[model samples]
Target: MSDWEEDWDNGDSKATSKPYNKRNNAKDNSISNRSDESGRHRSSENRAPIRYPQAGEKRSNGQRHKHSEKIEVPSDLVGMLIGRGGANIQRIQNDYNVRVDLDKESGTATINGNTEQNVKDAYNDIEHHLNNGPGSRYNSKDGSSGHQSNAIYNFQLKGRNNKPGDTDDIEMDPSGVIDWEALNKKAKKERAARWSKLPELRKDFYNEDPEVANLTPREVARLREENNNITVSRVFQQENVSENIPNPVWKFEQCFSAYPDLLEEIYKQDFRKPSPIQSQAWPILLKGEDMIGIAQTGTGKTLAFLLPAMIHTEYQLTPRSQRKGPNVLVLAPTRELALQIEKEVNKYSFRGMKAVCVYGGGNRREQISVVKGGVEIIICTPGRLNDLIEAEVIDVTSITYLILDEADRMLDMGFEPQIRKVLLDIRPDRQTVMTSATWPPGVRRLAQSYMSNPIQVCVGSLDLAATHTVKQVIEIMDDGDKFYKIREFVRNMGKDDKAIVFCGKKTRADDLSSDLTLEGYMCACIHGSREQSDREQAIADITSGHIKLLIATDVASRGLDIEDITHVINFDFPRNIEEYVHRVGRTGRAGRSGTSISFITREDWGVAKELISILEEADQEVPIDLRNMAERFKSMKDRRANESSKFNDRDGNSGSRGYRGGGGAGGRGRRDRY
Candidate 1:
């Protein structure tokens, strides 16, 4: 016999000498005698009779009987609960002063004791053993507790919380004492109650004007069909909105009549209807609510926010002499974007509202004079705006409407401090609107810090990838082969086809432009280092068909709308996927088909997986070589993560002696082999 078996037998003998054990022995003898007298019929009387020992009965025999509790154990856990030859069961019975009887066929264990508390304690012990396995001890305070049962269940269900080759799931608590199902039901009820109180959409009400009436059912159906067919998607007043806010209008004529002159201007521009961004952003801004507009490039985001600002200013117009400063301030990231916005401003700046553009490399005195001459709208870059504000040439205290265009680009170009300074100097109750092509973390932080209860409006999926309107051609080649490939592509193109080649550095652009021009190709270059006049001339030449080929940096990637550009070439990959999206967006404007080609090399391995994912999502054909490179990169990344975790587990510090002696050398060896 094993040591545990011998000890258990001796324990039973020692226990029989005690008075309580003696009383239990006598009761067992009486039951056995009754069973013998009943013979084979005893099997039919399996149910035990309920008996409650009174105080008087306890005095007679120095013992008492209480109610018995039955607990069903899982069939697989029967052996672990009973132990070898039933030693563990007997140990629990002796320690807790209870009777534990197991029905092997049904897997039911009935525990009886002198009191209810004793029965509960015995059941708790049995549960702990079953959960922790056969090696676990009874009456041990270190076992699983009630609070950790839910976490344990979740761990088991998920099969190793995070990574493979990990046994962390088995280490969680296994007490099984908590009622998880009841808790989950209660949480679901609370969620349902919260959703029941959400605001309902009032589709009939058009605007706050009392003259507009609710639309009929037939009209509503027609409007919905138009919206769906045109792909105009919108989410209105998402969070913390008042109950009285109305749904957005579908047609430009439905809402544009409030400003008849603006409607006339729209018709004069040959605009048939509002774009998706305009259709959604108009009503929210009209209601005087702060908003963040997210849409793809070349989708008319400029006019989306501009028209509403003009309408609001026209509604609260005062005499020119009485106006303190510009009523609306539009901030752009680049001088080119600022100029474009100013041009659009002129189209809708009717009704005696003057608009001016301010940027660097322009005459500072002239900009100062324009601001002093009392314009209703001022469009400028962040740097020039900050300079004018510090110079005290412009007063922003009276500004009521603030707009930040290309907001993500501004944050990317290290303009946050200047943007924040201008925001701080403006009026406290200004209705701020921010528009971006993508919503990175920095843009979200800026919105939370400055705006008040802003509504987010996304016109389409928020993907920082090139649109399907542009055909993407990906080529995997070495750095030395890029020039040869570009030469071949340019020779194959028609003489009148316009193309813009993008490079990573200013010096590279200048060098490439000089080489191409010397080789008898009409090419020009533009970057931040070039004079503003030179850059302006380059853009003008490209637009007027004087220069068919242009090499530039990321400055021209955004907000420069050239109409008939047929193709875009990325001679060098961009810093990220977002920049790549903008660089290719220069083409595919105004519903015209275009093409973009990229030269990806081995140095671009870090972003290979992301590039493949973007192309896949856009339904573009991916090259086989790039797919293999992405797979290799993923495997390398996962291996490094596993090695780092192992090192951290061995020693708290990665550079510790133990880790260096073990995982560090192994990692170096693996890298060498690779």
Candidate 2:
């Protein structure tokens, strides 16, 4: 056996049963003739370690020991053992008088029964019944079974496929062929008896529902309350389609057809429909027009510009025989986000197009090697990319396609200087495309400075943040009780549901995640201070479903795109109204409906008011109390602006200055972080 297999067998989980074959005796007159035959072993030797059964290893005395022998079972047979509500499993356990504990969270089960032999016998019986179809051996018509003696009886083990060696020889004798009619009669009688007593086994599992059992008492109550408030008719209530439809200046459908393989891959991954942003942005970008798309994260923004970038590269790429520098460059805000965009872009850039991802915090030597090898598409974070550019490790002169994803976050992270340098280093006639979740004044000004005659595309209203799939809710609570409320909500979440908690500052994000971990929640905190490797692992943990809760600062608010985040909790309200939308947008993604809940405190009344005003302008329903509170803050807005130095002098640098739109390519405006 391989070392990996031995290691798995030695774990707390072990298998049962070895393979054996039996043949009729030749000398016996009542039996048939004997023939030489070969059968395959269904035990550990034939199965891969990855799919090894994770049940029945420990003894009742709480002693854990490894079994020298191993058992092998088919994958289909294993699935049957875990019958509807695990009914078949219960029968075998009761018959053998053992205890079974299945841990779905760990993806393993434990069998605690007295002694090794009894546990082994129970496993064999369970395996035997499951190996056969429903209602054939253990399960009856309704998938039930009867209580029977738990004895480890011998049965010929068979493999799904026959042995390789040919065996056509058959020894025939009059005594060997005797009694086929009598055997059929006995088999029919045994089946009838088993069927009559199967109800007890069926009832044990038929009434069991894992979904209900998995939910906590609080979650069950919340689920019931949500359903009770709506009637069947009300649930299907439809709103009239708005007439103010967005008109795109350009549209192209067959553009991606040239790369049929790329399209097939996208569809195979189940991204069936193009998002509003993608539908609008693809045409302008494919036409080689500089454009900026303003849409929230989790709305397929990556693919919006990515498809166009890929399409353009198809025409502009250099011949494979001749090596060249990167023709397309994509710069994102954070390391995690840059890597994510790289992964998405690589999924489609096949057929001779070389795409490579470059980021900081690993091995710089490895990154340099990739750049030296020559790639047409480059996905990189600003700081790392800039370092490479400065060191002359990467050539940017050939770059004609420049994409700035999460432009707002990139600017916030002080990448403006690095962005300006990249622009200067790249081709003069380059097509620039910038995307952001929300188009605030800061992002608009940055676009004006960089893009030339660009077409602007915005999905939905600027005030309406996140996607329609995300249900938004604001709950008023005292500052002191906010933590408790959040804790209670998390405790009520279903096993499959995941939640991201957003905090205002990095320190707060770290503290909250730490606190949650200590409180028995599997969570990880991500922020600027964390190393790049750790950040990558943290994002992977959340994306791979290993960690259910993620606490992060605004660094996670934008940039990072993880699919199917069931909920987003705003532990601390955003500083700006635009950020409020980005924070909640993470939850509802990839066409899945999600929920966002924010705990509004007295200290956050100002920010809460602004958020409601934005939502109201976007045509969303707003509470009367929130609207009134928001109104109080608005009355003092102008007074506070006048007193502040930001707006004191219009002509002064470092103050709020009105935008003086730039002419030609790369306009200019007031400098702000996002």
Candidate maximizing lDDT: 1
* Candidate 1 lDDT by residue in tens digits, 1-674: 32112211221111111122333322211111112212322321252332223222322334556768888777767766655444456546645668776665666788878878768877877775565553333222555443254244434444211222232334323542344466577556755665454322111212543223376645534543554222222223345545343354656776777677778888898877777677667777877878888877788889988887877666654544666677889998877788788888888747888988987766767888888877989998776676566556778876778999999988877678778878877755678899998988999889988887677877556766676788888999766777778888877878768999998778778878887787788888987777777888998899899988889888888878886888999998887888889988898886777899999876666678888877887799999998887776667667767888788888876732322211222332321100
Off by over 4 Å in 1: 1-246, 642-652, 655-674
Tell me the whole-model lDDT of each prediction, alpha carbons only.
Answer: 0.68, 0.59
lDDT (tens digit, per residue) of candidate 2 on 442-474: 777777777765677666555545466777888
Give the TM-scores of the predictions, in the order they appear. Answer: 0.63, 0.56
Show where candidate 2 strays beyond 4 Å.
1-253, 462-464, 617-625, 631-674
Candidate 2 to truth, TM = 0.56
Kindly give the stretch of ten consecutive residues in candidate 1 with the minimal lDDT sum.
28-37
Error at 487, model 1, angstroms: 1.8
